[model samples]
Target: MTMPQTITVLALDVDGVLTDGKLYIADNGNVMKTFHAHDGLGISLWQKCGFHIVLISGRNENSVTVRANELGIEHVFQNSKNKIADLQSCIQAIGCTTEQVCFVGDDLGDLSIMNHVGYSIAVQNAATEVKTASDWVTSLPGGEGAVREAIEYLMKANGTWDSSVASMMQEHANQ
Candidate 1:
């Protein structure tokens, strides 16, 4: 498995990739999902390095919108029946090519986009076929800091991980 020479966009599938593939529905029909703090920080770090983040989900859940807003992710496509098309639109909107995108997914629905991106990643608990199609698989499961693991791997491969961490440490020291 070879890493992309450059990755400018990080495209993600929301359900199984950001959450643990579990859904909570209230009696009133409100759906809820949990996101990991570690993954949040990892995303922040990725954006701080000047990369873009986009979210594509097959379901239309308000929680996903709320979470994306909290993370300052501007490109969000929910209720997407065709992930590849949404991803292509996102790539165009961001003025980047498919070779500059890395997609992390965990299920069959994510397979199409995974195959279309430059680097495809699957979480530890991903479906067998999804894992087989991926360039890399995270050690952690989804909603368990798996996104963080993928971000660190990409940053390390791009030679930005050490410096980014150092900058964060220096900032903490000053604080």
Candidate 2:
């Protein structure tokens, strides 16, 4: 599937997309989530190319905030029961349109926004219905570099992958 040529924002669903959809709760009732480092680097690369990233999750968790901060993502909407609404607000705040957004999801909660965005992507382990509704499906499963895979696909589609990689390499060499 061809990516939307004007994509400027990447909206992500956290639980099933950034994570494996498994919630590890301690005896004290704190929830823990594991994020892939590869995905983090992918986000960094995407940002380096001057694109935007947003996280929208139905459930609120502190770890999500921590991770988003670590990645320097400014638009994060947790405890969002209505993802479409949150997405709209995000686009408005960022001065972008839905036609410039690509949403990556892995479950039913992600369906509404998927249909509204310019491009919809599903992780490999996503629900069958989600995959059916997606424009593209990643080869890797969620929490296992699927987000990174999606980022790479988007970068390539937008014709920014080669230059972004070269820039990163140059920066690393300078360091």
Candidate 3:
């Protein structure tokens, strides 16, 4: 089997991929979701290394806004019904091909985009149908370390994981 090209852009689905697939509403109709700090730092490092990242979601929530801001994520699309079309536009905006893109998703909404990307990754807790369609399965689940795993895999495939992570680790240790 042939390996996919080094990923230049990462497209992610919000609910399942970033927030463990739970949809909850508080008594006041507010939302709550937990985000992993490690995932944030990993994403920062990945961006510093020149990989572009985009987040796509069918729903909008407060947690997504906060997390995206914290991570310095560039492209974010929410309440999108036609996910595949939005993803195609994103790919074009990045000036990249399907061969240079990696998509991480955990539900059926993400399948079409996954099919078009070079690296299709699913978190361990993803739906069974999603798992079957993915090119790789992560050990971590969403809202845990799945995003981090995806970024690390992309860095590794691009031959920059070690040096980039080493620098980040060193900086953290010194601080």
The candidate that wins on TM-score is 2
lDDT by residue (1-175, candidate 3, tens digit) is 2254477888888887877777777899998877778788778888998888889999888678777888888788889888878878888988988778788999887888888778899998998999999989999999898999888877787788899978978998999
Overall local distance difference test of candidate 2: 0.92
Superposition TM-score, candidate 3 onto the true structure: 0.92
lDDT value, residue 29 of candidate 2 = 97
In model 1, residue pairs whose N, Cα or C atoms come closer than 3 Å (at least 3 residues apart or on different chains), thus clashing, are none
Q: State TM-scores per candidate.
A: 0.96, 0.97, 0.92
Top-down TM-score ranking = 2, 1, 3
**Candidate 3 has which clashing residue pairs, if any?**
none
Q: Of models 1 and 2, which has the larger TM-score?
A: 2
TM-score of 2: 0.97
Model 2 spans > 4 angstroms off: none
Rank by lDDT, highest first: 2, 1, 3
Writing each residue's lDDT as its tens digit, candidate 2 over 61-112 gives 9999999999999999999978999989989999988988999999887888
**Per-residue lDDT over 107-139 for candidate 1, one digit per residue giving the tens place of the 0 to 100 score:** 998888888888999999999999999999999
- Of the candidates shown, which would achieve the greatest lDDT relative to the real structure? 2
